[model samples]
Target: MTKIPTALLLTCDAQLVEIDLPFGHDCASSAERRAVLRAALRCDRFDVVALTRQWDMWIDDEGLYNHPVNPAATALAQRFGFTHQPYHGPVLLTGGPDAQGNTLPLLRHQVIGLFLTLQDL
Candidate 1:
């Protein structure tokens, strides 16, 4: 048995909100991911969103960070056009093109990390 890569969603104050370790072909859609963020922003319990897999961390930094957007995430952001400013931040999407031109997202057991800052909202 292999371990699934863990993804942690942390608030600006560094509170853990969600931890996702998706299973085979069960990656969350862009919309679903956005919804989680939206709900968090609305709660006011969190101001910053930080998603990390292992050592890779994506921080919106109150919309200050210019983190490179993931190609597949960019497409989903374009499609939804969420009004929230942080939604303009990078998202988590599946089926990204690989180096060999294979349309695969991350490894099945790999986690997708996404981040947004509610201060921009």
Candidate 2:
């Protein structure tokens, strides 16, 4: 059996929820993927948000790093005309892109690893 990565957990509208996904015999449809992204993003407030793996305070200290906004994030931003900004600092949450075009939940260590990879200098 193939071990699928865990789904990303998101707090939407104050509701902590996981992306709607199928398991075993079922696969998550594109509609489900859209719904998950729609709910996860806040266009009004987060039209353009920044993310980071680390902070150097001074720009010269280290080169800037940022996450590449994927299609999912871009679509959401476009729908609401929200700005899409990439960033690199510390991840307060645990998530990343999965094969299904949805964020997958990660452990603290996993998140740290991702951050390290993103901001590696």
Candidate 3:
């Protein structure tokens, strides 16, 4: 006889079904992945995704960074438009993509990390 592993599945009627998947004989993954699941994000007044990892801050579609860990990213930020704090502080909220095709940044961060991607940086 083949023994199949089953889980205490929660049904729509709020009942637990102690059996294999209702639709599948065996549908399970050997590897496990972790994720930070939250009911909602702590957004500011503008509803932009706030940088709740720390103090009052927010990130944006623009590649600008107040303090970047990657040297190349830092250089790129400066090239794009990055000035010292107090000099270039947060705009609270900005209207993106002006006539010059430049995105308005969400100013609020101390140290930031950059990721290598295929999309427009």
Best by lDDT: 1
Candidate order, TM-score descending: 1, 2, 3
CA lDDT of 34 in candidate 3?
Answer: 7
lDDT of 1 at 2: 58
Clashing pairs in 1: none
Lowest summed lDDT across 10 adjacent residues in model 3 is found at 32-41
Residues 3-118 of candidate 1 have per-residue lDDT tens digits of 43234444443344443423333346544544454443333122322222212233343433433333332333343453244332333232333454322334443333332322
Candidates' lDDT values, in order?
A: 0.35, 0.32, 0.24
Q: Per-residue CA lDDT of candidate 3, range 16-39, in tens?
A: 233221221232221110000010
| Off by more than 4 A, model 3 | 1-68, 85-121
lDDT of 2 by residue, 9-75 (tens): 3222222233333323235554553344334442211221323222111011111222222433233
The collision pairs in model 2 are 8-105, 51-87, 51-88, 52-88, 52-89, 53-88, 53-89, 54-89
Which one wins by TM-score: 2 or 3? 2
lDDT preference between candidates 1 and 2, better one: 1
User: How far is each candidate from the true structure, as Cα RMSD in Å?
Assistant: 12.0, 13.1, 19.8
Which is the leading candidate under TM-score?
Answer: 1
